[model samples]
Target: MDIEYSFNKRPTTDQIIELYDNAGLPRPTNDKERMEQMFENSNLIITAWDNELLVGVSRSITDWVWACYLSDLAVRGDYKKMGIGRKLISLTKEKVGNQSMVLLLSVPTAIEYYPKVGFKKQESSFIIEREQ
Candidate 1:
């Protein structure tokens, strides 16, 4: 299908919203606020686009010193298996550098995919709901 894409370290606001929305993943009601925090706290984020269309996204929170978390990776369903996700992961990891512990959350259906991109199981994370 001639998928044309590139990895970007700092994408525009429109690209961020578009890819995150098009990824079809369940996100929190505060996704917009959370994304703003991510951009502020994260050392780097990678956005992949197929031509001009926002198709994939992956972001990381890292210190480039000890630890990193590869969070919020998603690609459009129509763009799946096209290496867009892989490319985003690669770009994030490369930016994190070696000697950093990297991690991510994956669904049961997606567990196998991350290992191929150089991730492994480490520990479990959780969230406790608070009254809103």
Candidate 2:
């Protein structure tokens, strides 16, 4: 797999929706505007591509100094078990540097996966669920 990684390369909305669906990430793929805005507003984005296919992505909001919220991490279903997700994360951290901490709220299925890639489980976090 000759996967190439890019920082801040925005994938098309269709590509992102397809990937999120394929990866079982459970985002609002049905709402195109929301999906488009999601990526557009994100400050940091890491993408993995296999030739022309967008295979993986990591989307984050960061200040590049103190904290980075890795809002989305998705890899194509067929591309799982490869290191694409890990590499996307590694690149996200690399871009954010050591001073900023990377954080994310993992999907239930991925709760076990995060720790393997260097995310510590934080018990103090809280969230007000989105009404949508």
Candidate 3:
């Protein structure tokens, strides 16, 4: 099935949670308000659709010139291995252009996947763990 991709098309909370859950990405799915804020706060939102079904999404916050933090990249389980994730990242890079760098914090399971999609593992990055 061909996937239709779009930019800044903020998905409904339901669609976002569904994708996150099915993709095995840990998110506050039960908290509707938090999910709303997650998408609401992001500036760059790319989505993939399979004839009205939300199958994949790449959400990021960026300056559009300096750096892009790709916060979430999720695709439904059935859609995995079809290069949907790769395409989402590629489209995101296309949007931000060459001057800006795209960065992400990979979940333990996805550490290997990111490098395959043109991400170079960096050693100098640091993060203060989110207080849950």
Write down the RMSD of all candidates, one decimal each: 3.1, 0.7, 0.9
TM per prediction: 0.74, 0.98, 0.97
Residue pairs whose backbone atoms clash in candidate 1: none
**Which candidate's TM-score is highest?**
2
Local error of candidate 1 at residue 125 (angstroms): 5.6
lDDT tens readout by residue for model 2, 1-132:
699898856789999999999999999999999999998899999999998899999999999999999999999999999999999999999999999999999999999999999999999999999999
Better of 2 and 3 by lDDT: 2
**What does candidate 3's lDDT look like per residue over 1-132, in tens digits?**
889999956678998998899999988999999999999999999999999899999999999999999999999999999999999999999999999999999989999898898999999998898897
- Candidate 1 lDDT, tens digit per residue, 1-132? 555545444666656766666666555524677666666676566666656776777767788878888768879878888888887777776777787777777866688877787777667768685564
Q: Please, what is the whole-model Cα lDDT of each candidate in the order they appear? A: 0.71, 0.94, 0.92
After superposing candidate 2, which stretches have Cα over 4 Å from the reference? none
